[model samples]
Target chain A: MHETALTQNLINIACRALEGKGVTKVNSVTLCVGALSGVLYDAMEFAFDAMKQGTVLETADLDFEELPVTARCRDCAYEYNPVGFPYICPVCGGRYFEIIGGEEVYIKNIDCIGDDDVVTD
Target chain B: MSQIKVNTDLKALNNEIAAQNKEKLHSCGILTVDVLGSPGSGKTTLLENILPELAAKCRVAVIEGDLATENDARRIEKTGVKAVQINTNGGCHLDAKMIERQFEKIDLENTDVLVIENVGNLVCPVSFALGEDLRIVVLSTAEGEDKPLKYPTAMLKTDAVVVSKTDIAEYVCVSTDKLIGNIGTVNPDVKIFTAGKTDGEYRAEGLVEYILEARKNLK
Candidate 1:
């Protein structure tokens, strides 16, 4: 539902990072999306396609690398990927655990053409 | 083409602003709570019931977020505590920048506890940190027992859960116990509270007590 807003932020951040770097055109934007990030890839792609128009990312491809949810059992200090609801530790059967990863979306990198590569019209 | 390794969190700006809000609130010795839930989940009712008790002990203020309308702010104002309304104008969630703007309107030094009623939502609000000391998610019995499982991110991020409208559980054929069990499944460390009528009297004693205790412990 908020993919459009998120996509806008993605564009803004990418543009800000490229400021004064003499970048000519953005080729692709890569993101690291987590399983628990609650972002729908299809929605993100759709929003990116629509909002990237007339922007630095007009021709950029949206790429994603998914990260799995990982947790650490507090009782026994065991680390594992939670399988389903009622996430009990497989090793120690402890229910108490802390989520350690897979809950964030990060912009990994951007592929761009430098100003030096631009052909004179 | 060259790849620039930007490697930045999408929510970095919001988180940074949230951290600043946290420090500002902390310096003022104010305890802030962010309340999140779906529309019609009894978030306002829960606050209306608890605010009076809370106000009696300390100076309390409310920041209400909604898609449109000052109705909630008006409701909170009826309780005699000051309320600032922020209409998101169709935005799904309230971000840290919005809260930072409210600091100008609210007298933070005079307020001991600041309760922010987030725009009613189960999903979008889960991702944005509002610089709250405690984050609470309210779930009504009418919403059913599977919400915690279906919206694990909301359950995972909240510090506590309030199972509201227990008074209608029987009619709605909802089991509060099952709801709580599901909540525990997703977040084993989260505190849980229930609020509703019991024996013709509306009650949210546990939740009220919890809030007071949380504030006390903050000092």
Candidate 2:
């Protein structure tokens, strides 16, 4: 559900970014999906596929760089990926950790197929 | 075409709005907290009990979120407080924009504390920031002890966890110790409190005090 809003934001970003570049079409758009962000990649892709219709991203490929969940323990400053279910910091056995990574959802880059850029077959 | 490098965070716009909300709320000196839980988790019950106590200390207001009903707001209004309900209409969670719209309707200047009771669900609300200074996740004994493990995000992101409906702990098979322990395993720093039907009296003393403290120490 939220992915719909996110996908719409992505399209808006792409369109605005496309300005002044003379980009005719967007070939593909890459995204960095964080594991801890709680966004289901498949759902987001599904949303992008459905909602991008008739928009600037109509023909653009939606790609993801699925990142790993990482956390830093505030107690001992220990950082590690939770291997088990508890999500505890392995070093300090502390569950309270400041999530440093794996919660970021961002655009990496947009592949624009302009009149003068490299053409994709 | 040309490769136009553009890096944008999907949460950038939302987070920006949330930040703006935070600034607006802060400028008004309103300490807002987002209270979240499951559908039947007794989140509203906890608020029903605590709102009066909170009102006794400071000017308290509530922004209740639901799928399509103003029922929760009606319930909170019975306590003689200003409560505005935002119907998501089918949305899973309440976002910053929803809260922003209520700024005018909520009587911001006179309010010392604003409690945003988010759409009752365990998942989506954890990901959406509603410009709340603190996040509280309420879980009742009836919901079982596996909530923290099953939906860890809600527990992990909250500043406090309220174990509501403790009076009926005997009826439910879930152990209070086990529930709190599981919550600890998820987020050790979260302040935990037992609310509702404690020792034959409905009380959320610790919960009320915690919110007041949070309000007093607002950033």
Candidate 3:
């Protein structure tokens, strides 16, 4: 829903990261999106495509790596990927568990071309 | 051609501001609660019932977030407590920056509890931390029993779940027990409360008491 705002932030962060590097163009931006992050992939891509115009990332391709939900049972100390709703520990049927992964939206890295990489016309 | 490593959480800036908001509110001895739910999930109605009771115990202020309209803030003000309205202008959630901007308008030192009614959304608001001490998700019986499971991320991030409008559960063919049970399935540790009219009186004493207790525990 707030993908537009988030995409703007993504651009700001990338721009800041490349400020002093003499980068000529951004090639791609990689993001790690979790299953439970509540970020709709299609919406994010749409927002990126629209908002990236005129920014430093105008030509950058947005790449996403999806991570599955993982949890650890507090009772039996069992760790496993949760497959369905009402996530229960497979080993002990314990409902009490701590989510250990798949709730984050992280900017992994960016591929860019430095000024040195551009051939003279 | 180079790949620069920039491993950063998208919400890092918001979280940083949230931590600052927490410290500032805590320093003034105020307990903050962020209320989240879908539109028409009875979030405002629940607050209308509980705010009077909460105000009697301590100074209470409310920050109401809506995509548009001052209606919610007006409703809150009718309880005789201060209410600040934040119109998101179509934004889906309230971020830490928005909450921080309201601090100057509110009498922080004199307030004991600040209830922030977030823009009615079960998705986007769950990701943005607003520096509140407690995050409460309000779910109505009319929304059905599968809401918690369908929106597990919202349930998981919340500290409490309030099943509102329970008075009409039977009329809606929804069981409050099943709803509460489903909530526990997704978030076993979350404190649950129910609010509705029973025998011609609004009931949410458990929720009121819970908030009071949370305020008392804030050191």
Chain B vs. true chain B: TM-score per candidate: 0.98, 0.96, 0.98
Model 1: per-residue lDDT, tens digit, A79-115?
A: 9998787788899999888899888898988888886
Model 2 TM-score is 0.93
lDDT of 3 by residue, B125-183 (tens): 99899999999999999999999999999999899999998999999999999999999
lDDT of 2 by residue, B49-162 (tens): 888888999999999999998899999999988899899888989999888888889778898999999998888888888899999999998999887888877887889999
Give the distance in Å from residue B115's predicted Cα in candidate 1 to where it truly belongs.
Answer: 0.3
Clashing pairs in 2: A113-B1, A114-B1, A117-B1
Q: What is the per-residue lDDT of model 1 for residues B1-219, given as tens digits with 9 covering 90 to 100?
A: 677878788888889999999999989989999999999999999999889888998889999999999999999999999999999999999999999999999999998899999999999988888899999999999999999999999999889999999999989999999999999988989999899988997788677778778888888
CAPRI grade, predicted model 2: medium
The most accurate candidate by DockQ is 2
- State the weakest 10-residue window (summed lDDT) of model 2 chain A: A112-121
Q: What is candidate 1's fraction of native contacts? A: 0.69
Candidate 2 error regions (>4 Å): A75-78, A88-96, A118-121
- Model 1 lDDT at residue B95: 95
Better candidate by DockQ, 2 or 3 = 2
- lDDT at A54 for candidate 2? 84
User: Between candidates 1 and 3, which one is better according to DockQ?
Assistant: 3
